[model samples]
Target chain A: MSAAELHNNEMIHGYLNDLRRYLSRLAPHETQEVIREIESHLFDVLDQQAANGQAADVAEILRGFGDARQLAALYVAHIEEGAPPPRGFRAIQSVKKSVTASLYFAMAVFGFSMAFGLLFIAGAKFLLPESVGVWSTPHGDSIVVGFVSVPPMATPEVMGWWIVPVATLLAVGVAWLTRKVLLVLKQHM
Target chain B: MNSTEALMEKWEVQLRKGTLELAILAALQQRTLYGLELLKLLQSLPSTTITEGTLYPLLDRLKRDELVDAQWVQEGETRPRKYYQLTPLGNKKLTDLTRLWRQSVSDIEWLLANPGPQPLPNTGV
Candidate 1:
């Protein structure tokens, strides 16, 4: 169906948003220039289509132009580098995107792992009997430090042996994941 | 398609991309035209199949490179339209590109007509 017939303003807005976001890497003025020209061209095409009594869907025409990101890449590449701009940069960009996604996934997995690991230890200490718990004693509950479980009744020597190193490793991992998540967010934003 | 056909398709796209600017310059050589008029003119040509997708970016690039200049002109009750005309630099560039294109065409035509020799004739060895 024709975008004009459908009067799909939301789809148009979403398309423009994607184009704008894709073009955001260009210098502000350059980005604005490309977008303005594109907008004007799109309007002219639509007007011509309407004048011809043919309801050519604006969305379909935009789709014919291909993906907004790809169009933006072509615009930016040609504008910046002149005619016959080198291709394959989009492949590189996609790889970068995948890496960023991997970082997010890794961060989420690590964050959930740490949180659930700690919660499971706490849960086991409270729910399970002291005799059956990983290291809980009859006196009190157990606390998790990295891979080790430390009961309140444990010896100071055992605590000193595992707690410091395990805690340090877990803290470093959490900190690293947090930093990675922030870095990825910063890049996207 | 096979690898060679795919390669030809890729080259065809590249060739088209290279020629579009020349075609736009050639179109603007005569007089000023608005985006829609220019688009219509190009569409009318048997050699050009460009839609708005390729047109605007090319126009913007031409304007950026100082090959063409644009102005907003209002006519009657209609909205203002950006009209484009070639600059002196664009004219000179167009001439050079046209000369090169003609030479390439001539060279290719000659090559087509005289494609060297057949391999070993009808030798069954």
Candidate 2:
């Protein structure tokens, strides 16, 4: 019989969740995936040992891996130096920070864009129908173009694409600046 | 154990501490074992014990670095266990570290064996 048969699936689920949460400080982006890999490696080894009739304690097994402080310190040193992440993990932390900033910026831009879109739609509906057709000062032709009943202010073309990229870049800059400020202030803290 | 040995256990972690990573890696080079098994093996050596929180993280770092490879296997009808083993790189690192450590020990021993502290006291009134 294997470990799955001995314990409920929920136990493993909970255990894996706990492991991910515990490792979050170090590998926030790939925490769960990293934990799963480690967990799989551990279970395989433990199972073999158990096959030899040796009793095992999961927590102790986990603990024997060694001190996280020293390990985290090494990673943090790389981060501060702006060096690549250690061998297995990539140094995508700065990327994540940039993306997170961009997301927030996008949300802000989205709210303003939506307001602009709505105002354009409403302005088109209200102002276009108030007059039969917009008359140009130089032409004698008042070319009847609208049904007046439907409003002719064709919605102002939304420049969502422009907003998205601009917002994202602005957000990334802000996030980068914020991180620098925090790092500078850490000594005082 | 002698009286000095007993005293050393309490205060010696500070003294023999810089090479702990070397110590742990050397221990792991012996076999592929899970966290607890590694801990037990390290402890079973007679005079040392390492905390669990500290050990596991270091192991994860090692695994992440590809210095070690780990796998999970079902132990019983109940739960799976994780085990670690040295990669070729890890073995090489262990071997190099061992030689360096041995050299340092010899160098330090040689230094300690030959020491002269004869300085005349300066008296200025």
How does each model score on TM-score?
A: 0.54, 0.43
Per-residue accuracy of model 1 over A48-150 as CA lDDT, tens digit each: 7789988657777677567888888767875465554234345667788888787776777777677556545444433543322333344445443323343
Global lDDT of model 2: 0.58
Tell me chain A's TM-score in each of the predictions: 0.37, 0.31
Q: Ten-residue segment with the worst summed lDDT in candidate 2 chain A? A: A152-161
Q: Which interface RMSD does candidate 1 score? A: 2.5
Top DockQ: which candidate number? 1
- Interface RMSD over true interface Cα atoms for each candidate: 2.5, 5.7
Specify the highest-lDDT model's number.
1
DockQ of each: 0.28, 0.26
Give model 2's TM-score versus the native structure: 0.43
User: Which residue pairs show collisions in model 1?
Assistant: none
Put down candidate 2 lDDT per residue, A59-108, tens digits, no spaces: 55555443444434533443455555543454466676676666655655
